[model samples]
Each structure stands twice: as C-alpha cells, then as structure tokens.
Target: MTETLPETAERLTVNTAPNWRYMLQEYDELYRYLPAGGSDKIAGHQRRVREAIARLLKRNADVRLQPRAVKPVTAHLRRALDEGRTASLAPAVRALDAVAEDLSWQYGYEKVPKGLSQNYAYAELAGTRGPVVAEDIILGVVLFAPGCTYPAHAHKGITESYVILSGAVSENHAGVYVPGSMIYNPPEHLHRITVGKSEPALLAYAWMGERENLHEQKMVFTRTRK
Candidate 1:
C-alpha cells in the first residue's frame, strides 16, 4: 500500500530541521521574484512553480537529511555558492548551504556519458526522492564545471524551468544566460546546456507534471543519427 501524504508528513516530523523549512521559504522567494519577460506562458509557469511550492509549504512537508554524497563536479559548488551569495539568488543559495552536507548529488542517469560525470551533477531539494517528500513537483539545482557541455535531453511529460543562480550558461546556443535569467522548456522540448569557460554555473530548476510522471520520470539523453 502506498503512504498518503498526510501519513508521510506525520512520520517525518521528528527529523526535519528548522533550516530545511527555511530553505523552502527561500525557494518560494526565488520563484516569486522571477521576471516573466512579458510572456503569459512564462508567467503561467512561474505561477505554477510558486503555487506548487506554496502548497508544499502549507503542508509543512518533512525535511529529513539524506545520506551525504558528492561528485567530481561538486568541487565547483563552493565557487558557485560564493558567486550566488552576492547575486540575486543569494537567499536560495544560503538556504541550500545550510543543508549542503546532507544533499545527495546524482547524475540521474543509469549510464552517464564519459566525461559528463565529472562535469555535472544535480541534487534534489524537494521531490519524491528528496529530503522533502512531495509528488506534485520537483525542485533542484544543477551544477556544471566551466566549459561543460550537457548533451541534448528532454523531460517526457514534464514542464521544466531553470533560473540561473551563478555563472553563465547557454541553452541550445540561444543566448548566454547570466545570473537571474530564467529559461523555460515545455514537455519533451529537446535542449542542451553549455557553461561559460571561466566560471562554474549553478541553476535552480523546477518540474511540474502529473503525479505519476513526477514520481516515475526517467532521464535519458537524445541521440542523433551519425
């Protein structure tokens, strides 16, 4: 039998810290300040992200510490955080640092491409598999080493968005997205990311979709015919 959200919440209350709770609040702030760029679609995505976060906050989801883990790319985390502290995403970065030791960074792929493992990794802040147990939304951050090129990929049935917190990156070579920029990708929208050469990049992302999809989504890169 599956555990209901209320039951999960009740069982998780004891281990959650005040800092974890504050992190969610900071995330709410992060999404709240995102500029819509005069696009209703963008505004709608922002609204959904904030509203989902609001719902999670209202439920007071438990935030228990996961086992600490790291990746080669995380070595750049310190620099990213340092840069973010003075950037517009300062609040979110600070809150993330409070629970940094407990974050479990992963590649999210069954088979990571060569060199990619050392260049990138992501950690979930709130989701079905994260410190916060939620089914409707996923909140996380991805870190990339300088000059990293993340291969083309897309989330099936998931509408996603990323807000650059530190350094700079270009998605599909469209433009350089500096700190405080927002990028939106609808479901199954193929896209690729490349980080700037001089500094590591950190981006906060959110995914919203059906409960089943949100819980069971798989990660796979798009391959091109040679």
Candidate 2:
C-alpha cells in the first residue's frame, strides 16, 4: 500500500542533483517509444505522460537525491539488470537500472498475501512524495522478483500506464509483454501481473486522475492467484 503523503507544493528537495537529473532524463528516453497506431487509447496515454514530464522539467529544479538504504526488492532489480546485460533491453531501461539503487522505494498493497510483500516494490520520481512537481500525477519505476505474482487490484478514479522496461510479464494471464511494451488501465480496471519464471521484471509507471488524488490515491487490492 502507498503511504499517505501530505500534499505540499513547496519546492521539493532531493539528496543530490545528479540522481534527480538522471531520473528526469528517463522521461525523454521513454517517450521515444510512444506507439503510433493500433489502440488510440494507449497512444494518447503515452502522449499525456510525455507532455506531463515536459511540464515538470520546465519547473525549477528543487531536488536533493541520495542513495536510499537498499530494500530487499532491490536485490531482484540488481539480478534482473545483470541478466539484461545479455538480453535485449531498451537503452532507457539500462540507464535507469544503473541508478536504481539511488531512488527511495516502498511496497504497495499492505494487505498482500504472505511473502508477496518482499517480492515487489516501487520508487516514486514525483507525486505527493518528495520531488513532487505535478499534482494528480505519479511517475516511477516498479519491480517484481522472478516468479513473483503481483496480485489482482483495482484503482478508484485513476488512469494508470506502464512501460515495461525489462524482463517479461503476463497481464491478465494472456499476452506476454516484453521491453518497451506499454499497458494502460483506466479507472477500476482489474488486473494482475505474473513475472516470467526465470527473470525479474522492471516497469516504469505513470498514474493520473481523481481522489485528492494524491494522498488519497486509492489502489485497492483484490484476490490473488492461488
């Protein structure tokens, strides 16, 4: 479960300048893959994220970035990055991985099934949390350990998008998604993710919509596959 971060428009601070810069650089690196055809919904969602980041960059850089204490989930990120050395991954994924250790990360779905908690985590670049530039929008990276299954969940008043950075994940038990694949879920879209058995998965995500929509962004957990 995401924490209830109090909203404050104060110029945010980071632990260091370079780490913040690298994270912002990922916005451009990721925008290059916005799909041109097929589903207009996805194409439009990608465009919105790109534009939002563009606006974020125009704001004054009030950041302080530092290496956060490594969490257990980070181990899987490290392992997946090591595996990606030989696998085909987007250059943006590689760049983000190089600085993965510097971002602060947290677990989602507090009531998740036993053991699943340690298998997944996310790092926020902007939100109610620090480095917050835009309101009602969230940009971050999420990771799951190999063989981990992020349980079924639904969001209230939120539109979320994810760009798969590395490894593979099965969404809704169907399509096998790989690097650069984009997934968009409208409010209340019920979905779960299962990582490939041998490699972990890393995904860059953006969420926007209602609730106070920041501190109150509600991501409700449902059942898990048994």
Candidate 3:
C-alpha cells in the first residue's frame, strides 16, 4: 500500500540534530555509488558535499521547524520514488519521507522566465533557511514537477552541483541526466532544466562559495514552452 502524506509533522523540537544526522548520512551514501574509473568530477563534488554538511552541523537549531503547505506537484513525489531507478538510494528516498510532506513546495515566481509554469520546492537543509545551516555552502533538495521547466539561471561566486536521486532532468544544451547523474555548474554558468512529464524529478543540489554573493544569481529565461 502506498503511504499517504502525513498531515501532522513529528514535532522536531530542538532535537533537530538527529534529523541533520540523517540528512548528512544520506549524502554520504552517495560515495557508495562512485564509478570505478574514479571520475575526478564526482570525486570533487563528494568532498564539497561532505564539507558543507560538516560546517552545517556546527550551527545551533534555534528556529522551530514548521510544516509548510504541500503544493499539487508534490503528489508526484511518490511516483518518482516508486519508479525505482536506483535501489542504492533507498535510504535517501526514506529520508525524504521524514520531511517531504512539510516542504513549502511552490512555483518559481521571480526567478522563473516569463510565462513558464515550473513549480519547485526546496529545503535548504543547511544555510539559507530559518535556522541557517551554513553560510558559505548550502545543502538542499529540489523538486520539479513533471512537465515543468526550470528556466535558465546563474549564480555568482557559487559553484553548484545536482545529484539526481530519481526521475530525469536535462540541463539546457548539456543533455539528459538521469538517476545517479552528478551535474555541476560553476558560478555565472547559465543553465535550465526540464522534467519528464510522466513523473516528477528530484535533485539534491549543493552550493559552495561566497554566500554573500548568492544574490548575484538570477534567472535568464529566453525560451518559451510550446
């Protein structure tokens, strides 16, 4: 039986440390799937991912974690998980369960290109959120509903990487990235993503660099969906 979304979020209290532990543990699990060739591309990302998590763990869980309204696109989360693209990601999938329902899933407004109907919900687990996990680096999950297209955008002084947990995504002019694909973008590199229409796409993205310069990133949408 499919587990329904829980309405009552388990009160995290000030004991969100365990939750953070699970989150980091999930990121660490990515190391288990490295290619035998030892691609330096992925290796570098793994290191940064760990470093970001480490920095986040040092902060205080001062703010209360609240459950936000679930957007209609979140309904596809289960479909993405059930697709079973990568079993090694089971733990990561399970981790989302603990917090997915509470996510403030919403459409990109100011950042989206003109007239594009893309909806995304991201939990900046570390830094950028209420509690502020880390300042220089960020850890978060991005959900793109099927048929949604994330317009081209770029960041300044921030290097970004996206680890596909399930479904598929195409970074404009870069080609399609499926399960287990590690797509990275440097600061000021303009890129866009389109999700498969039949199922939703979920990506665990990391941002490393100057946190103060993050605002320098903005959407630059030039295409319209036909």
Candidate 4:
C-alpha cells in the first residue's frame, strides 16, 4: 500500500535523525571500554556516564540542529580528527567527525578573555542547552589550538571528566595525557589545561550533577591571586 505523505515524512525524519544518536552510542562504547586503571573512583564515574547515556538513549531524545558556527580554533579541528583517527579512540572521533559540520563552537564565557578568544572552544552534544536537551548530564567536546593554556577553572557542584581523544594535554602540570586517557575532576576541583605545542588537542567531556546545577552551570576562570 502507498503510504500517506505524513507517514512518509515521519519515516524520513526517523532515518535522517540518527546521526546524533549514533554519536551518543559511540560515546557509550568509548566509555564502556575505557580502562579504569584500578581506581574505584574512575571505575564508578565510567559506569555512571555509560548508564546515563543508556537511559538517555531509551528516552529517544530529539535532535535539535544548532546554528552551525566556527571559530579560529576550529581551523585545527580537521588535524585533530585526523590524528584522532589513527589513535585507539578512532571510533569516538569518527562519530564526532560525522557531525562536525553541524557543531556550534563557543567560548562559553560572557566576556571572552584575550588570549583564549582564538585558541579554545567547546561544542555541547547533550545537555540543557545542547542538541539533545537533557538536564542530568552534559556531554561535549573541547578543542584546543597548539600551545594553548586553558586558564584555571572549576565547576561548582559538578563532577567532570575529560577523555582525551587527540593530541596531548597536561593538567595542572601534573602529567601529560595522550589519546584514550581519561582525566577526572571532582566538583569544585580547580584545574588548568595546557596543550602540547605541535598539534591541536580534542577532548570529550561529561558533566554529572544535580538537575538544577546542571541546568544553571556557568563557566568562569579563576582569579590569579598574587
């Protein structure tokens, strides 16, 4: 039987909208296979992120197409993806690459700091203000130009984790992280990131917090006290 026009349109929408949801599935796979390194804290975090994504998938959240935008730092995104494709985290990177053109990169600051204006940006994939429209968890990617220093910052009431997908970064001068490594930061834990000088770094991050806190989350750099 010939389908009605509305039925056909709905089927088309369903088929075409799987791109973003596929990206989320890739994220779940990435988290599921990541090594916990025997740290119970990390193990728990990984499990929670995977479970939240599972629940989100069951809900079949609608995908909202963002107004495509780019920044100076995005010039390195291709290189980042290329490098990421050769790493252990290739699948996750490929998923992001699929939707790269639709991503809306922003500095997430009201008044942009000087040096950072051109070197760093983030695109949210799922959250209160992102395409997926969720309040319990936020998933996104952050890109950094070579030799960029992301000033010290902390998220209040939020436990955040970053999975390095490409290039390398150092957190608080503590250690260098390569592709497929996960860095975890508890709520209100002040941290700084510095990308290596040779290539851009791309990181996938997840934020888990109370509904109100997740909805009202703000990004602010810490003041340097002399």
- CA lDDT, candidate 3, residue 165: 81
Ranking 1 against 2 by TM-score, winner: 1
Scored against the true structure, residue 220 in model 3 reaches a CA lDDT of 48
Alpha-carbon lDDT, every model: 0.88, 0.72, 0.65, 0.89
Candidate 1: list runs displaced more than 4 Å.
1-16
Better of 1 and 4 by TM-score: 4
* lDDT, candidate 3, 157-204, per-residue tens: 778888888888888846888777778787787888888877788888
User: Backbone clashes in each candidate structure, one number apiece?
Assistant: 0, 11, 2, 0
- Residue 113, candidate 4: Cα error in Å is 1.2
**Candidate 2 structure quality by residue, lDDT tens digits, 146-202:** 889887887787788887778899988979988767777888899999999888888
Measured by TM-score, the strongest candidate is 4
For model 2, the stretches where C-alpha displacement exceeds 4 angstroms are: 1-16, 64-67, 84-89, 224-226
lDDT of 4 by residue, 81-189 (tens): 9999999999889999988998999888998889898999999998876687676899999999999999999999999999999999999999999998999999999
C-alpha RMSD by candidate, in order = 5.7, 7.8, 7.9, 3.0
Score candidate 1 by TM-score against the native.
0.91
List TM-scores for all candidates, in order.
Answer: 0.91, 0.82, 0.76, 0.93
| Residue 73 displacement (Å), model 2 | 2.2
Candidates sorted by lDDT, descending order? 4, 1, 2, 3
What RMSD value applies to candidate 4? 3.0
